[model samples]
Target: MSETVPTPPSPTTRRQLLARTGAAGIGIAFSGALSELFTGTAAAGNLGHGGYGPLVPDPDGLLDLPKGFRYRVLSREGDPLRSGEGPVPSNHDGMAAFAGRHGRVHLVRNHENRATGRVPVPVIEGLTYDPEGKGGCTALTLDHRGSVLSERVAIAGTAVNCAGGPTPWDTWLTCEETEDKAGTNGYTKDHGFIFEVDGADPRRTGAVPLTAMGRFQHEAIAVDPKRGVVYETEDAFDRPFGLFYRFLPRKPLGGTGSLRAGGRLQAMRVPGVPDLSSIRETGARFDGIEWVDVPDPLAAGTPIRFQDFGPRGITHAQKLEGCYWGGRSVYFVSSYARSSEGSAGDHYGQIWRYDPDRRRLTLVIVFGPDTDVRLPGESPDNICLAPGGGLMVCEDGGGAQHVYGVTRRGEVYAVARNRQNVGTPEDPEWGEFAGVAFSPDGDTMYVNCYAPGTTFAVTGPWRG
Candidate 1:
């Protein structure tokens, strides 16, 4: 928070803040003007690099772990599996890490693959592995130093598990990134459901889909035990503007693993604003967001029904993707989906925060809609919070894909460049930032890249 920072005269007046941020970096502007605006005081804003800087690719390529930090590779695609199931399958995305006694840790990670003709490996234990098809969910045992002590294919015989979330009970909720027909031979598994895996439970069943979590092309999920609600994001690429969903479990409790039964599935409908017609897609930029509870969230289907009486169906230009929990609130992010605001492009993506208490949604940061901080054609696939109290966004599109960390006040920086990971040193290609998870202590981070993708355990100090 510096004295030179500019303050907007009014909420409608954004230029002063914009200029300061773009020209002066986030540090001075946020602390100076931002603090004053939010608290009527000018203090050092933790916005700018706070010491953290721009995103880096092949982190080892240009930089070393920050002071007091270290990292290791816990697992990567093509790595050998201990279960004699063969090499680790392709597409490592959405993951969770938890502590276990005896110097061991439980991990449940996802693989974005459809049930191929055969799934020799039970990604994890306790899975039906329907002959229809299976391709997702793997559980493992690891050390803090990033070594796989003993690994098991947790769940198998599923389809495209793109991204999922960590539960309070130390389990992983793997979500389907697409909706496939269950009747088809290779597509027997039903469309869109969240599966659970127990990293510590060696006897744990392979992987079992949480039919209670509902069915749809689920991208990610965020759980709130207090509310008995499980929030999820959808990646409906075939149908633009992915929807935001929530599962109101029939029962909400803190008994650890008691949430796998079933619940009501509801999609978010921005109140007051009507649904966007197909015509809105081509010219869409960003959806003017105003999230309201859907009436009867359980009665969700194409011809919708509800409890809150909100709008029905997905809006234009908002393929909902990526999510995280923060400030007693839940966040939902968007990508590629067109919006009327011109903010949905590779160059820029938007992050929206949903306050459960207020039952309201607000826009905290808007990036890339302009020339300055935009990615060439970046598709924000998924995201999680960083130890630095910021967000790490996974760029899942194009050749220059990378991970971006954004400060709470909206200063975006690239802490890691993944394009070169596992690629020929001289020939690099941008890949998808599929899965991300931080250790319980927030001292380390594990990033999984898709395609010849490698998972890197990165540890560092929270500079800001």
Candidate 2:
């Protein structure tokens, strides 16, 4: 199978990628040469000292950031829980940051919970896989000036968990978003999968699922630590849309990174784009890409992206959620698209970019259903890859919940907002920003609010 032919985007890089991609089709373009090369200058009058400049408004009103930045909530769902077990476990959502013991900084987080009694933890029997499934993962630690120093639970039960990724042998793949199964809705076991969480012994972590990594509904995951490949993401919000996976890993990661020693679960095909909901424009490229095998990566009820993998074609992405792996390519996120939800129509967010050395798959940023334009979030779900370079998104749509930051010349900056406010006086600060990581010496910048779950860090000056 060597018909290799993928080298053609060089008329000066396709005119600098058509002068930084934007405006291809699908009724909504944003104008001004794609909003001044990708949504920068959108709203945010003053506060740019590189970034983190004009936010300061949090007198304990939750988070606002900017001005020497300064956050550090560390952990807080129900609070307490410093390994004494109990409490500190709510929605939280995707997170990752490693390196601890002396230098400190472990993180790990992710609760997202999918029901079944709501919240409760302390079931570390043999590192639980589904005590009844309320979701799991905690491990805090911190300190190197970020504060906090203990908060445990690591892996347990496992259900909605949500976004995860950070493992070039450091561990923390989390996922689960929900395929439910097992005794139906009451769940005895059999939730959408992908579990591995150790981050250097987060309570001996091990609920093992990796079920060949497929299940559907999983959300975020991105790890190509030089070809160990794992890129998953699927929020699937209705009408057959949600795919973009890639597991590969039969054996390539040497030591104790452990992908459970099972792999091969592809899905991602843009060949001639049959019906990926018509590829909702924005920069819309989709060069070549191909990958199809996925008979049933533990589907149990069928949903390997609607499986059929025969002539090899599969494409979905409407709510593919977050995914990140910087430069060498892999930066997914298709958070919104709506033909009333069946997609291929009313998009509100996009951002693709795959490129594994020309296998191609581009669609760099799109968001049409104006939230008052100039880019300030609409549904851009959890993503992270901005140690000053590009992407940082996280704003599950709806209002006053930012954490944006696009730049790599694509502009868009509003970094951190969420003024956390729940009920009473009729709700307003609608918390959304979930797990926006960056702290392996990239200073500090952990996120997460997802409904009173909290866990900040922030720091200052980061622009690249």
Candidate 3:
């Protein structure tokens, strides 16, 4: 991994530039130590000023929230589901909340179960994409008060359904994070495809794969509601690195908001940046970035990221994980670039903002190695913009795991902490927070604990 630091973006005023960049609403909170490391002056201390000062330890030893905040365990693994076919699955990764009937919110969540694990959703003849595959999505309806009304297996028979984005027309696009081939591993159909599930009608929903989107290990996606373009990220950890993609819907979402009609897929390419290793600094920005059409949208064997597509100039990241569409920019995370284990690249984490209007990509936040255990560095996985303000990041790094909050002013704070210790006494109270999203009303926030598979709905004074 190279430590090359290219020239930073033109010296623009931080407030003037970042505030108007539409990143203020991004869900990416860092530690207070990161704030002091990046910026010279620290406006806020360990926890942001406006946020609830510090997290009060939970009595249940599950989730620790602020003084005025409390969380309810909405769903857990092995619990009886409304579908009656199976119980709630483990490893809840990515999720989205949609407006439901009678002022309720419908949450479509992905189960990141691999082929070897038990199938989360039952195999229906017409609905199952691959019967042997053990990954899919589940839907839960929550009342206006943030309580779970009902839970059901929404989609089933997919392989490693990891992370995906919600459609403006009310639907969930679940992606498979595996490239497992068919006829192998007892799979009758190929894996590594994005499936669309109706958020409202999960019971009768049709599980259809959007093959036009390239087949790869997809992590997360963000849809541009205005242009109807969908931005996707891949969790590629191999040599070549993963390419960021955007799908241009051919007909856009009509009354149905279905992506089944198919579309063209393109990869992002930084023209001037010769190779993908030029971006090394915290605030590096590239101008006039372009997109190249992927040669084969549904190509197998070789993924579009590594395939010899055109100039092969698509900028690749170590592990592109979470992505969310902000007011005008697409904020994406590169989960730890330049690994110590020699996987590839440098830096622990980076948040890049793609400005479609300026046709440029700006590096907003970068996480380097920090020695402070109380306020250590973080590797953010699944991220989303908080309704109150700033970004809430799910920490996947070492030490105590937390949902850190990054304010618009660049201040970092810990929003919530995980305190789960089940396996053994040696096993620390550590669990990664994923699929963090707030309800439409902005009063309730929903997140998941990856291991024991617990979904929590936290209601509190969001503005505080």
- Name the top TM-score candidate: 3
Q: What TM-score goes with each of the models?
A: 0.75, 0.35, 0.86
lDDT string, candidate 3, 1-464, tens digits: 00011211222122223323433332333322223122213222333564566789888889888788989999888788876767788777789999987899999988888766643666656667778878898889988777777887788889887789888888888989877788877888888899888767864457777888878888888888888888999876566777889999887765343566778899898876633444666567789888889887776767777777664466777678889887678888876755443344566678888889899787777765433333424577888866654567887765456787776556566788887854455434355778898888777889998777889998887762
Q: Which residue runs does candidate 3 get wrong by more than 4 Å?
A: 1-50, 203-205, 255-258, 274-278, 339-344, 370-376, 427-429
When 2 and 3 are scored with lDDT, the better candidate is 3
Q: What is the lDDT, from 0 to 100, of the residue 139 in candidate 3?
A: 89
Each model's C-alpha lDDT? 0.56, 0.69, 0.73
The superposed Cα distance between candidate 2 and the true structure at residue 192, in angstroms, equals 2.2
- lDDT for model 3, on a 0 to 1 scale? 0.73
Q: Write the per-residue lDDT of candidate 2 for residues 100-160, one digit (tens) a residue.
A: 7678888888887766535655578777887777778888877787777778888888777
Distance from true location, Cα of 297 in model 3, Å: 1.8
Best by lDDT: 3
